[model samples]
Target: MSIKPENINLNKIFIKYLNEKQYSKLQLHYEKLGKTEKQLPAIIFYYACAITLNPSSNIKNLKHAHNLFEMLYVNNRHDLQLLCNMIELSFRTQEFKVVLPYVEEAYKINQSDERLLLGLSKIHLYLANLKESIKYYKILFKINPKSKINRDEFLTSLNYASGITQEYYLSECKNYLKLLETNKDLEDYNFNFKNLKNNKIKIGFLSSDFKTHPVSFFLKGLLLNFNKDKFEISLISNLHKSHYDNITDELKLLTKNWININSLSDSEATNLLRSFELDILIDLCGFFRGNRFQVISNRAAKIQACWLGYNNTTGIKNMDYLIADHNLIKKEEEKLYSEKVLFLPKIWNAMTPSNILPEIQKNNSIFTYASFNNFHKISDDTIDVWSKILNNSNSQIILKNPMPSSIVGEELKLNLLKKFIARGVEKKKILFINRKKDFQDHLGLYNNVDVALDTFPYPGVTTTFDAVLMGVPVLTMKGHNLNSRCGESININLQMQNFIAENKDDYFNKALSLQKEKNILQNFGKNLREKVLKSSLFDTKDFTKSFEKIIQKIISK
Candidate 1:
């Protein structure tokens, strides 16, 4: 039956009760509407809204909601509001696959809607559809050049693009920075140089990830081994405490000063940092989330450098240096970066090993290749290359799902599985593992892996170190950019250059060759820990000394 004029009143009351969070009233109003074909849209819309408001309330709890949606699907409701609400609910619940059809339908009705464009862009990016993300970001930029989300997302999309050249990426970064500079009142600072007579050199580090992050993992070694008499260290953290605050207490003891600047505005933060009068300020969170570029822009320290948190350039003109090693950044590549290169003498990062080691596998005839890198790094080109390797070898591949607990995470895993299956690889041959809660259990998974295959154009850094520390050899494909060469850098430090491939064909050949030589793999696996411990990769004391020397020389100059 069609909706009567009186039924429209019930719809309005239903919405009002839903907004007021009057579930009892909302149920009364919904019942008042009665079961009619025209009322189905309103029923479904209200049901979705109720579930969103209270997550414990499922759509199944209201039998009419499901039946209404199915009926509406068969016969067009043409209700944009209902579609929008459904999309909103799906997004809120992280049901991205459920949101796609609703988004597509909404987009058709209002192509020029900014919210629709932004939502579509974010959804594609979340789904790891890099090309589609870039497309929508470009459109959003064209429509609204001042959109900060579009600018940030565009840069992130560029980072994930494996085919993009360094020059092109640099150009985009410069243009983005130019826009930001023009929009803000960024004033340059001129600090009077004062040479300390006998006091320690005051150094400050800026980062939002001083807790259980990879940045903290690599940075703790330097902080722990610092020459306290020569340098006084301080930290400006943007986040108070994270679940991964394993080194929090240790860091506080090592640091002379620790400031939590998460609550401060950019201007306020810059002023606070300037008050510290830091001799050297190093930005660990370069272009990552919660980055205080304004503090560096205002010149909070005499010398400023970017390191660790991000792999590429920040494109900020005031930033003095981008710390790297000769391996990660070649002299020729320095021209593309916005900041001057500070080439560390040894490995740029020094990893602290876990005391608990997984028992190395000794009996497996079948060689199992694995990669624990994040899924975003596994681009289409990377998948194609990996498929070729799998096709060439009789070995099966294992991948770790970084966010295995979420719906989006599961979707990403399914997408990867589909891509592998399309490449003539058997579904049973591929395995997707979840991230382990305990760090020891996480490392223990390395026991199952024969060799770790590195993701191209954005290779593993911490994953590589962990694999080698666990006596698993990582095969990395070298690329022109810094993001791709991180694994290679670690390999070079561990003196495993033979595992690094120059190109795709070489990468495949290297894997196949390694699979054939089980004795070499076994020997490498047995002695890998000793090799890493002896190398500069874990030589924290030496790395700290060399790092301090570089800072001293920079200040002296």
Candidate 2:
């Protein structure tokens, strides 16, 4: 079980490669030591340390590495680090069911360890165990209140697809401000008041989701249609270089001023942005992740606004405006926000789906329901509702999100089936499909779906838009908060007000009714796209014009 005296230095070399993240070097070492009798122990060690950790590892290699890990774990069951590594390896391989035992084993050794706590929280979140995920996050917050990364994760976990109280959400967002002790002395962007009326208003948008995200999808039409002569737009991107793609390049071309603040410190990012001398700065990312709270609180522009990036109010005091529509944020609930509501006339955002969309496919034999939103949004209540719909209608629901192919995917599906089985839904009535990677392929999923059931409290926005675009009717429930009302706004704009439900019971009844109304479904399938195309939601030009006028009005004051 130990290396020979002469080969002891190999262990040090392995540590050096791993510590330095020299994965290639580790791979070379693992390859060099392969299939030798005397080096068998070292080979097994390197398999986990090197092959398992390889970023570009193939499925075969990962499976092999997992097998070696199981062999190693049998004798090293007491080793905490080994258990943690195995847990991580299982994660990489999407074998989430196998990780629980490893996590439990690691927990016995040290419950308060940050890594274990973080891993636990994330896995729970992934599996839609919101209560447990929040429990670990609360524990992490109590352990380290000032940990920015933890706080960001904690904040994101709070805003689930299901709803929370407006007051509670507001309080937590305000508490998020404490993490950034306001550095008010940040150097301000100088304004040329005398020449301002004659110059193009410089508007800067700050966000990490400039790629193929929901934010990017919704912003596409507006970004494309912004009047170049009237507004000088600058994109401040917080996305890392590795994630940059064709969409990023396309977004970059939307404006001449594109800055990457992904790697910079808060002070550095703030100064660089302030250096741009933007007249209006928009916080597209409130607190999801990579949120520059310090910069948001400090000065970087003449006017700062919070928009579609977050579902709730960003508690930054200096955030002057929250871009809204009457459908999104109500006048009575306006008191919950820290900023002035800049209400647009019709809709807050509009979407332009892929120019060449995939043709919708239909299943005539059986009724099919689907949800394409993130798995995190699938609350227990939402699951129960969907189950009821399926049970009543004798239909199936297809979850076309990012579920893996491993035991984790199976377990997640099984976990869902258990919930449905309890509610008297057949396992066969609940279908699970892994998400597609390509945009066309992703949209192609809607072909199998007849009606897309929107998640509650945190209903689908982009997914709702996409389903409507794909000619599938969506059933959504209205909630009090911004996240909950996104579906309501979209449905109203689509002129499909009947699709919007007053409550969970309404949502259920509507879904069953939609399933029963085959003639309506057929007519909807034929005309929904044209309806969306004709609606305000698809009129990018007008949405942009309205957006500009709102900005002009706000800045004029």
Candidate 3:
């Protein structure tokens, strides 16, 4: 049935916004349009209400909006984008659950709309549906083969919460490099390195992860080592002051200038960076949430590059270079980036001093297996591997995480434990921990654990660093993707290849062998602390030199 042209007039609705009463009358009239025309009018009415309704009117209006969307039964592309916009706005207003049905519908619609795919992927990740999230990410990657933006976004989001699609991670990395070669803008990324001598190069570091974040953990060492007299360090913080923590406090003291860019408009942030006259702006939080990727698009900084917080190169054209080491990024693998590759001597990650307690060897009665990595990284394959380890060693697994603290945490813990038990790991053997104020006590907790298990597809980076620092050896599986291969990187650098496993049998064999050689394990753990301290991994001074060299080289070009 064709509706009258008067039905969808957007201008007629705008005229009704002269006053509150008129707006209400217009909204009611829009709702009536939904009753007669099943789909199009319903979609239009919801779209209008979603945009026009005030906070006081939002809750009631949102229900009608959602109902309208459901009645529309949208299966087409344009309708899907509109639905995504509706769901995204709902998420902003703490209406997280209300969007799920729409997300489900979106998943069923096309699954190829890059935006829809990513939005739905995020919701699944938020819900801790790791496998489902990976499924959608894989589809998104396949559809946008040339899109570095989609690839980087999918990988970054996957890496942060759960893990990554191992098969896609490496291929995408190579594709990004190929894109970079023809990228003329980044060809002479080394232009201003010689200019480093002309004046102190104004270096700006941008990130939303400046507070109590893993990015901050790795960055602290580099910032502490920067030659403040030679490099003027400016920080573009895309974070609210209310969210500030002790980590931010520490970082604030390290940078030469700190600007809170969260509240500032995009134009405001651009003007502020331009005013600072930044010669080299380093983007630490590449494509991660609240990252201000648009700032790079604006070319606010003269020289922009993506560094260590994220592993893969950002697909953004404006980002000039990606800092990598020889091991993590192979020379043969350089063609997969959107930015020119600048290889460093070793792995880019550097450790810092953060009140870490010394390792205590305890003769706890129970043989404990501990994995401190996040719960999302705990995939079905990972759980199966750990259950095998437990069965082989006759040991209990203690899975400790900072999440699952409150009542919600308890429920999540129970659900996860049940999943593990279903896979053959005894329910009694598994342990879950909620938030702990003094994470320094984690070292003491490690005393109860004889071994620390690593998750694959996305192995632990900082977690491995910490486990080693605390003298707990991590048993890791090497795989094809960069996400899974980091354990091999750690093993190679630490001179502990024996600690790395190639396959399921090798992983189980390594765990069993380590258990038998308690003395060797103890000695290795003690020496791991010494090894990290002596190795390039902990050499902040050298790392700072290497980092500055890259910056100087870029600036001189």
RMSD of each: 4.2, 3.8, 6.8
- RMSD of candidate 2 to the truth, in angstroms, is 3.8
Minimum summed lDDT over a 10-residue window in model 2 is located at 189-198
Per-residue C-alpha lDDT of model 3 across residues 1-557, encoded as one tens digit per residue:
87667655654554555344465656655556554355455445445554445454664566556555544545443566557656655544434465677677656766667887877776666555677776777777678766555555555655533344434454554555455444343323333232234378888888898988778888899889999888888878898888899989999999878888898876677666766778878888875667776567566777788886666666666788888766566666666566788877776768775655655576567677788877767776777778887766667877777443431344346656877778777777887655555667755677766778888766788778877776778888875544456777877788878788888788888887777775745576677677777877778888899888888887888
Model 3 poorest 10 in a row by lDDT: 186-195
In the range 1-557, model 2's lDDT, one tens digit per residue, is: 75576567777777788888887777776677656345655556765677776788887777677766766766677655665676667666666777676776676677778777878877787677888888887777678776655566667767783546778777877877776654445444332323244378889999998987878878778888988888988889999999898889988887888999999887788777766777889988987777787887765677899888886787777788998789978889998988888889998888775679887656556888889887667788898888778777768888866433543465566666677788888888877777677878877788788889988767887788888888898888887877678888999888888999888888888888886675745678658887888888788899999999999998788
Candidate 1 structure quality by residue, lDDT tens digits, 1-557:
87876657767877777878887656656566556544655565675456456535563543334344435654664555554555555444455676576666777887776667777887777677777777777777778776666565578668776688889888878777766565344343454544553277788999988776788889988898888988989988897565326567667777889998888877678767776777788999876667777667667777789888888887878789888898888887789899999989877879767766777664455789999888877887888888887877788888885444643456667767888889888887788888887888888888888889988788888888888887889999887877668888888877789999999889888988888774745587768877877889888899999899988888778
Question: Local distance difference test, per candidate?
Answer: 0.76, 0.77, 0.69
What is candidate 1's local distance difference test score?
0.76
TM-score of 2: 0.87
Please give each candidate's TM-score.
Answer: 0.86, 0.87, 0.73
- lDDT: the better of candidates 1 and 3: 1
